[model samples]
Target chain A: MPVTENIYEPVKAKLTNIIDESPLIKTLVLVPEKEFSFKTGEFIELTLNGIGEAPFTPSSSPLVKDKLEITVMKAGYVTGKIHQLNIGDVVGIRGPFGKGYPLEKFYGKEVLIVGGGCGFAPIRSLLYKLIAEKEKFKKVIFCYGSKTPKDCIYKTLFKELRNIEKFQVLRSVDMADEPWDETIGVVTVLLDQIKIDINNSLAIVCGPPVMMKFGTIRLLEMGYRETDIYLSMEKNMSCGLGKCGHCMLGDYLVCKDGPVFTYNEIKGLPDIWR
Target chain B: MEITVESLKKITFFKEFDSVTIEKILKISELQEFDVEEKIFDEHQKLIDIFVLLEGKVILGINVPGKGKINLGTIHPGQLFSWSALFPPSISTAYAFADVPVKVLSIKASKIQELVGDNDTFGYKFMKIIGQTLSKRLSDTRFQLINMASV
Candidate 1:
């Protein structure tokens, strides 16, 4: 593959809309000056000009080239600053780094998606791809968990997903508040309630560290193969390119080689869940 | 609701039990239903029957002095609740209520105790399942505690 000459340069993008997902998370819609396309699970470096840049997986569908959507959680200084920006502010976007979810491998198989918190961002993108090519897969099961009902992002998307044929959306809140009618437990518990043929299914997990660890363990117990379990790992990725050692997971660079990897690929790596 | 061995076999908790054992358990169990928000048991209340959720959701909570009812976890179908009845003291650890219209297989704790005492194999298998359930709940509670502390 040929590399782009201006790998360091960023294309300008105008923030078009902001959707307040939760108290601490927001989804920013941006219209890039140039058509930008990325695969479902790829990560992009979003620069706030002089403030700083952070890596985020686009929450919008990869098919939408004219614009991108990034879901942001107010976790640190850069994100806190990003949260303060209003509509019409311009931001810089660099490379659509890392290998993405392999859509072809998922064809003719059941797709099980387990996500929590802001991890729903990338999974949402993948969901869009799956929905567009719904005939390719046998079934899709999404199990999501949040701290509470108020903390759940993409609340409206669940209803939309449920309407799609061969798609099942199940949600759980670690704690419950009034007017909430769904399962209440950790996200892994949803695994028990779902009936899937483990042999013909692919399990995808993206979440906070603790959840990712436990969710993987639960999937393993449910008879999912290590090679069939894919995890979206988040690391301190300073550079979207592999040159920066900031995002190294064992010998692999999370930014370049993967933000998406099968459990078989990373199980031996130390502190992967963290 | 009619209680059948076949239906009991469908539940994860009873799946390992033989038909004869399920029949024995069925003799000591009956189907019970609760309306939405109906309190099934309170913390410190003497538990007489252990329940396997047949359908709907159950919210387990603890009553704090000022916080009132603080829901800690949810019980899903095919899962067991109120295992305190199987142990000594037989008092509930947390209060449980119907999060929705709920159905459960209520098993008489004393009869289960009698069955366990009489059969060593049945006792071992039953205890093993209970142990697994407790282990899972412990991990879940630890996860919830970490989540609360972080928040």
Candidate 2:
């Protein structure tokens, strides 16, 4: 957030807090030294001094520039280093690269969001954007799935989101041991349990490949046209710019053309996504 | 070939998890149907859930760009497709396609996490199930790589 001299400006983003989404996933809330603007679905590259960088969405809405949040899971090398930073640690940040969700398209329609694991990060940003224009959409339903009750990231705030008048939330897991009150199955299974008007709705899904694959298949089966389904893809997106082929899925570069793509645009691509 | 809990109990990974726990996993996991020669998991796909071979076989493949797809190994019953789903936002390391009419016990990753959260003991037992599958396939992959090099 701090404006400095070089391309690799050392912006002192003070980690305001960390929200544990799950055992290995946490949302790091930071207060930038300066205001940084980004779209609802755009991403910023977070760099740890010695480690490296990874692309992540500012889970916080663009409307709120004073504070920004990037949800990270302790996964690979760079991300594992990100988890090591404490509140008040300084981490370098770059532009809010990539396009965001098409808020204009869902201006007056029902929107269904299906997110899984860390995939919830970008959707959280989109949700915050939609909440600003809550009246624009008739209804918004979030079907989020995590591995366990404890494995479920954002378990605490999800209840608050559920309280939103225009929102309906359902949390599910594939397997439960002792006892779980919520639905127990894949997040796609939540589709069968809910009533959706595919003709008048748009579906946004972000998650692992299998979930997205099956979720998209079920949505298509339920009459949700390919164009109506939007997906946020994940790969080892090293460079936020298209120059690096790390995030290329097909003809499209995830860093440039997407992070968010319509199902129709990517349907012809092998394996359903990039 | 059909595989039941009764048959699985004969394996070491299924030994600790009782019939009930196995039944629960079996009940929650769906059987994915795939056609022969159809890709089950493509290289571009995001890796989320892991697959357990229930019937028939699958080929773990890598796209060599210039040489087309190179078969890493074949997945058989008691083997897995992608165990990386245990970690979130996992990238699919390879392409998985059906070698024959295949049915796999497709377990949603969230369920695996929930089970682990509710009971680590239960989760560890299940991890063992996949871990054994992984080890077996890893050795198989080593063999395949050796064969490829030899040629």
Candidate 3:
């Protein structure tokens, strides 16, 4: 076994590479000072030394130990600064924290992952994990949406994956233009285009709060049991340890309890999904 | 193109209605087609008919003051579009463009209003579906707005 850094102490990391996903979005490929490991759906707090830290999920596959990746959209202060930083810059990393998607439960069943915008980041991580263990699952349906032709991310990756014989990737844009050949609509609309055996499948939805709500509603209406639906609830997780109450959903701290939760577990908690 | 009760029954939008009733509704409707990228209607245009997509895709967008067109949603097969045509002060709220060659069933607003006036039973069923479409779109649009909010 190799030595690992303390969980609480932030470790140094170097941004080894960068890919411009969109004008406002970038994927930072970093090499952590120590080996890094995170289950699908877990998140990390990236530090800019004195600037501050924000939580993001690694968009790369966990099976790959050589490097880690985080796809960030330039939305807030921390992310805007991240967008401006060069490829060789250094940052701090503090985790593999929080419970991740229940990979064990997904074995031998169909998995449908629906995500929109930057919310698709964590789902991308989970998708890669599932792709690596292809024989374990019966089927995988991934539907992703963006605002426009220019706003979609993972274009190259999706183009490649679509060529694979087994991966089912349905993409839509709120609006599309010339040279765009995919579906045009919110990602949820993709749900209507396919047939899912709701009784034997699970739906993992992570996206804008609004998208999650509607997507869940659509799934429920389609006969998917609430218990089988998993959601990634986004919150301001300042403390990776879950000690901070910033990410609370009633008694559950999103950082400690979940960045990933079954719809049944959180459905009873009022407005947590709101 | 021609629309009959048989064709109308095949559309999910009118699936709930039986042959006789759909036939009544079909008298006021006409089958229309749009080529890719054609403007089905523009924001603020007079809303003369309500359309139900029979095939292909339609993209909806609202024009911003200086930001150009921002897409709001898409219409798929068997889904209803241009609900504003059925309401008062009828005018489009967004621009709908055909993303692919599309076939749609257009029902004249005046004829639909007359039919609804004459049959209270079918009127309720018709209004209910429109209400559901409006509610669903309102909710999806709300999410779109929230997701587009700063940061």
Cα-based lDDT at residue A60, candidate 3: 91
What does TM-score give for chain A of every model? 0.98, 0.94, 0.95
Query: For model 3, what is the alpha-carbon lDDT of residue B79?
Result: 92
- Which segments of model 1 are wrong by more than 4 Å? A1-4
lDDT of 2 by residue, A82-103 (tens): 8878877888787667777888
lDDT by residue for model 3 over A1-274, one digit each (tens)?
1124566678788999999988888999999877878788888888897788999888999887668899998888988899888978999887878889989898888889888888878988888888788799888888998877788888887976687656789988765543466776667778877767778899999887778888888889879999999999867688877787888887889988898998988988878755
User: How high is the lDDT of residue B147 in model 3?
Assistant: 55
Cα error, candidate 1, residue B51 (Å): 0.8
lDDT at position A26, candidate 1: 97
Indicate the worst ten consecutive residues by lDDT in candidate 2 chain A.
Answer: A1-10
lDDT of 3 by residue, B1-151 (tens): 5667787787789988978888877787888999989999999998999999988988888888887887667788899988898898899999999989999988898898888889898889899999988887776666556656623
lDDT of 1 at A128: 98
Provide chain B's TM-score, model 1: 0.96
- Between candidates 1 and 2, the one scoring higher on lDDT is 1
Q: List the residue pairs that clash in candidate 2.
A: A21-A153, A147-B110, A147-B113, A147-B114, A148-B114, A174-B111, A175-B111, A209-B46
In Å, residue A48's CA in model 1 sits off its true spot by 1.1
Q: What interface RMSD does each of the candidate structures achieve?
A: 1.4, 15.7, 2.8
